[model samples]
Target: MRKFDAIVIGSGQGGVPLAKKLAKAGWQTAIVEKRWIGGTCINDGCTPTKSMIACGAAAHVIANSQEWGITVSDFKVDLEKIVQRKNKVVESFRGGATKGMEKTEGLSIIYGEAVFTGEKTLNVILKDGGEEAITAPHIFINTGTLPKIPPVPGLDTIKYLTNTSIMELTKLPSHLVIMGSGYIGLEFGQLFRRLGSQVTIIDRGKQLLKHEDEDVAAAVKKVMETSGVTMHTGANVQKVEQIGDTIRLQFTANGENLTITGSHLLVAIGRTPQSTSLQPEKAGLALDDKGYFKVNDQLETNVSGIYVLGDVKGGPEFTHISYNDYLVLYKRLVNKEDTSIKDRPVPYCMFTDPQLGRIGLTEKAAKEAGYDVKVACLDMTRVARAIETGNTQGFMKAVINANDDKLLGVAILGPEGGEVMSVMQMAMLGGITAKQLREMIFAHPLYSESINNLFMTLEK
Candidate 1:
């Protein structure tokens, strides 16, 4: 029997960091993982996807070099090479995480699947069919989510791809059919289109990115359209079948029979928590109806000395947001510092062609929250900086409390929208006013400097 001060499971984004922080605090910390360290964010999600997108973007630039007063004779993309590069990036960080953890004192790394045999006792199933029991005062669950494939008829028969399996594609599809309009689907659609694949996206909703502000979502939709990505909303996909060499998608759109056949079919609907394998019921831990672990503010579960954090607990599922959970829980548990997941303005980004970033409340949210709201928006075409950069394709919007003129939320949809939202995120979190942004001098010839002018254009 081995004893630990704290045990963290699933060495992904949230678990590894939590284990490291606790070990550094002189606690006997142990991190248990079923697969490689650094989890999905490094292994599959953000890192590999972004790296592939970068290659696709570079290929687009090369294909359109004539527009930049440069001419190219022969241009071709080696899809396998791009994938190899992406793998290198994943491997680089995975090795670093392993090596770095090796240097930490009072830290033990176990390569096994952990389940609760009792409240404070975990039964670890080793890779080679050996089992060990470990006891800890506190436990953290950081297992992330996996892509969801709905029970569409014949979907399994047809060769399909998800976020996990798509990276294995060795050649570009002549036409790619994507079955969702969420961030994951949209981002991949853009990437494939840039890489010279004709893309058609089908969503069951009335518009793309239904969760985003209408104006921002519309802007990204327009950008994708201009870049040759066909989008269909209110789409009902009936079945997917392999018609000889091509995969055929049958759907109903606009009350008409819609059939699309392509070389690849990608199911990017969404993800669900990967907690099914953990069998949490044996430990007296209750999961919400939505399949997420039920936890209090301090990340403690119903079971004493057991804590659950990250995507398994279910909130905004961002890698950095999980890291923030690590900070809050680690402080309270090991350092005796108190923190809670409340009143924090979390900024989220959709990494599409023009990108989209939003923080705090929208005008609709602010008004619904019983505050008089004022709104301001400036199109990128009207901004001198954007025009100079030849990237005038989006807008900047601000929502303010009408009574006190305090900044409420800001949405940006344009070049580096994610970077531009950081300023407004800081303002919303720190209680800065709209007037402060308008009055402050920003650097010249930069896209973000347009924020000052956006606030100044307010008509309330």
Candidate 2:
């Protein structure tokens, strides 16, 4: 049996960091990955999505060049080249991550499917038809999630794509039908639409981004509608079938029978945890009522020397949250710290055109949590910098606690909205009050000045 001080399953964000820490801390460590290195964010999800979005943004700029008095000629999307470039990016990072661990002290990288053999033992099935036994004092379950595909009739028989498969397409679909209105669907819908595809989004929720405040979602829906995204909220997709080189989607929305046809269907419903395959029960690990690993405040699982974090633990599923998990788990593992992955203002961003960013509680969430909430909202069209940029669309909403003058939450749905929300995240993380943020110096005619102006409207 090969023995190590620690073994980490999955080479995603959490496993990468924990493996590095264990090796750096003078402990023998090993990371076993069932697939490629660098995990989902690097290999598929974040990197490729952002690359394609960049192409969309470029298309938008060229399309609007006439507004800037620049004469432009034929601008077309070379999807094949874009896919190649994105693959190059992923390959570069995968190489770097693999190399980073190659020389790490007392660290071994295993490429295999690891299963629980005993409480502290693992049976690894390598791709090369080789079996190996490994034992470690501690095991970290960092196996990330897969795209959640709902049970839609005829969904399997048809060629449908998820975030994983969409980026690999050699050609853009003439028309794309997205199957959710969540961040993934909205982002990809906007991206492909900007790149010249007729995009339609169908969601079961009454509004896109149902997790956000209604006003914020409404503003986004308005902008998206203006940008030509056909959104069908409260819509249920009944089936998808192949119809003469096209895909026909059938659904019911608002008591109406609807059939939408497109060249491709992209399913962006959500992601599901990959825990069941690990058989955590064999290791005395219990999953929550949801499929995620049941983790405590210290990020520890029910089994001693085993822990869980990130998406598998069922919190915000941003790449940054996984990094934060590394910090919390690192402290607990190295210094024996008393810290748990507690309350911090976790910011989430949707990379739609102009983008959308939010941190801390939503207006409804704060009020529902029994706090006296004061709101300040303003349209970006009225903001000086937004007007200057000539892309004035969407709005900013700030939710403040009335009794304590503290910043409860801030949501922005406009140009540079993602960049603008970092200050709010810092404020909530550092316990900065709303009054203080309002008083902070912001340069004139800047997009961020909207933050100050929005706070100025806060009423007691």
Candidate 3:
């Protein structure tokens, strides 16, 4: 049995930095990870996926080189090389995380699965067939989440790929059938399509990105469709089975039952929090209906001195948000500052070709929240930078408070959309109004300069 000042379970985005901070504060911290060092962001989620997306983006550029007046005779996607490159990036990040923990004083990295044995105690099943009991006055859970596999008939009979498993592919599938049209599906669908795979996406929703504004969703769909990705909305997947070398997926859309055959089936429905294995019942911690650790605004669980952070605690499951969790907890716990997660503008980006960067509320959400909202929309074709790059495929939209001209939300779905959205995020953070933004002098011929035009469309 060993005792520490604090025990951090799961070396995830929040847990890693939190542990280091705690240890640096002279607290004896033990951070336990069952597998990997930097959690899902570095191991499988953001790091590896973005690396592959970058490769796919390069492939897209090379395939369309003739548009740039460059002629390329032949090109091929080496899946082996792509996977190797992604693995290298993952390793670099993971190694850096491990080294950081090692050098930090009062911090010990434990390799094992940790389960709550008592309110302030953990029993770790070591990776190498050993066990240890550790106790601490404070415990932080950041186990994160895993890809959720839907229960379709005959689905488990054949091997299917989840977001994590699909990354291990060293060979491109001839035809890839994705089971959802959400962010994960859209990203990988376009990725493999750019990599020369015939991609098909099926979704139960009537429209892609159902939560997004209709026009924004339509624009994203149009961009993806123009890029040669097939989408079947309003699709209800019924069954899946393997026939010879192909996987057959049976689904119905618009009263018509159909079967689609693909060399690979990717079940990208959603993710489930990694709470089941922790045995939270032992610690008497209650979970939400969706199985996430229920936490207060300060990210404290029902149990005092026990906290939950990142995806396991639910809400927006972005890496940046998870990282912010560390900041919130650190400020509240270490600096003794008063902070809460409420009323924070959450921003996220989808890594499609023309990235979809979104912040704050959508127009629909703002309207639903009873705000007198005014929307300003500008096509990418109108943006000088988009016109110069010839990558004008999406639009920029901003939702403003009609009474105060304050930006409620902004969505940019064009070249460098994520970067442009970050600027708006900062402006919103600083309480910049739409009129002020429109009058602001921005650098010419840059994607961000479109912000001026975006707000110019707003009625006074």
Candidate 4:
């Protein structure tokens, strides 16, 4: 049996940093990881996906360069080379994080699967085919999540890909069929299409981004459709079967049965927390109805000396949110500051061409919350920068408190929209009002300058 001052389960953004902080604070700590050092974000999720997206973006730029009066030909996508490049990027990031964790004093990283045996005791099934017992007064869980695969008939009999496995393909699919039209499905759909694959996306919802406002969702759907990816919204997938190098998917939409054949099928529906292995019941830890760890505003579990963080604790599952979870816990545990996760601003960006960056409430959400709101909207085609670049495809919408003129929320769906949305995120944090932004001086012809024109809609 071994003991430590603290134990962190999972080497995710939150666990890695929290373990490092505790070790640096002169407390002995151990981080138990079932796989590689870095969590899903660096190892497979964000890093690899975004790297491939960049490759696709480059292809898109060259293919469309004719609009700038530049004639080009003989363009080709080296998918194997693209996968190598993505692997290199993931390797660089994961290597750096591993080195930092290895060098942290007073910290030991155990490569094993940990299962709780009691409130504060656990056994680790080490990678080397051995078991070790360990306990700690404090335990932090950042296990993140596992890919949520739907239980459709014949799904188990055929070889299918999840978001993680799909990235490992060295050759482009002749036709790729994707499930779920949310951020993950959309991003991958556009990426594969840009890489020269015949892409098709199926979703049960009528709109692509089901949670966003209808207008916003429609605009995104239009952009995706224009990119040559087929969208089958409001469809129910019945089963999938693969026969002799071709995969067939059958579904129903509007009472009509439909079938799709593709070289590959990607199941990107969603993710669920990895809890059954932890055996939280042994620790008396509480979980929500969705199997996520039940955490309070402070990120604490029902049991004392135990806390949860990152995607496993559920909320918005962005890499930034998981990193912020570490900060929130560090402030209270290390700096002894009174910080919380309650009502903190969440800003996320979909990495589509003409990215969708969003912060705060949507117009419908604002109205539902009983706040009198004023909406400001502007099409990207009217923005000088977007028009000059010839990549105008979407729009921006902002919701403001009509009574006080304060900013409530913003959604930007245009080129480099995430960067532009950060500008609004700062404004919301600083309490900058819509009228103030309208009158502010911004550099001419910048995407951000469009903010001025966006707010000007309220006056007209």
Candidate 3: list runs displaced more than 4 Å: none
Model 4 lDDT per residue over 1-460, tens place: 7999999999988889899999999889999999998899998789999999999999988888888998788699999999999999999999999999999999999999999999999999999889999999989999999889899888899889988899999889999999989888999999999999999999999877987999999999999999999999999999899879999999998788999999999998999899878999999999989999998999999999898889999899988999899999888988999989999999999999879999999999999999999999999988999999898999999999999999899999999999999999999999999989999999998999999999999997
TM-score, structure 2 vs. true: 0.97
Tens digits of per-residue lDDT, candidate 3, 1-460, equal 7999999999989999999999999899999999989999999899999999999999999999999999999998899999999999999999999999999999999999999888998999999888999999989999999888888999989999999889999999999999988899999999999999999999999988887999999999998898899989999999999999999999999899999999999999888999979999999999999899999999999999999989999989988888899999989999999999998879999989899999989999999999999999999989999989889899999999999999999899998899999999999999999999999999887899889989888754
| Alpha-carbon runs more than 4 Å astray in model 4 | none
Model 3 poorest 10 in a row by lDDT: 451-460
Go through the candidates in order and give each one's C-alpha lDDT: 0.86, 0.87, 0.93, 0.93
Backbone clashes per model, in order?
A: 0, 0, 0, 0
Q: Give the TM-score of candidate 3.
A: 0.99
Number of clashes found in candidate 1: 0
Per-residue lDDT for 1-460 in model 2, tens only?
9989999898888788789988899989999999998888898888778988888888888988998788798787899998888888888888999998887878899999998877889899997789999998888888888999999999989899999898888888999999998888988888888888899999999977877888888888987787788999999999889998999999999999999999999999999998988777778788888799988888888888887767888878888888788888888778888777777558888888788988889999999999998888888877989888788888888888889888888898889898888877887778788778788898887788777778777643
Q: In model 2, which range of ten residues has the least summed lDDT?
A: 451-460
Judging by lDDT, tell me the better candidate of 2 and 4.
Answer: 4
Model 3 lDDT at residue 58: 94
Q: Assess the local accuracy of residue 212 in candidate 1 as a C-alpha lDDT between 0 and 100.
A: 67
Q: How large is the C-alpha RMSD of every model relative to the true structure?
A: 1.5, 1.4, 0.9, 0.9
Error of 4 at 450 (Å): 0.8
Candidate 1 segments whose C-alpha is farther than 4 A from its true place: none
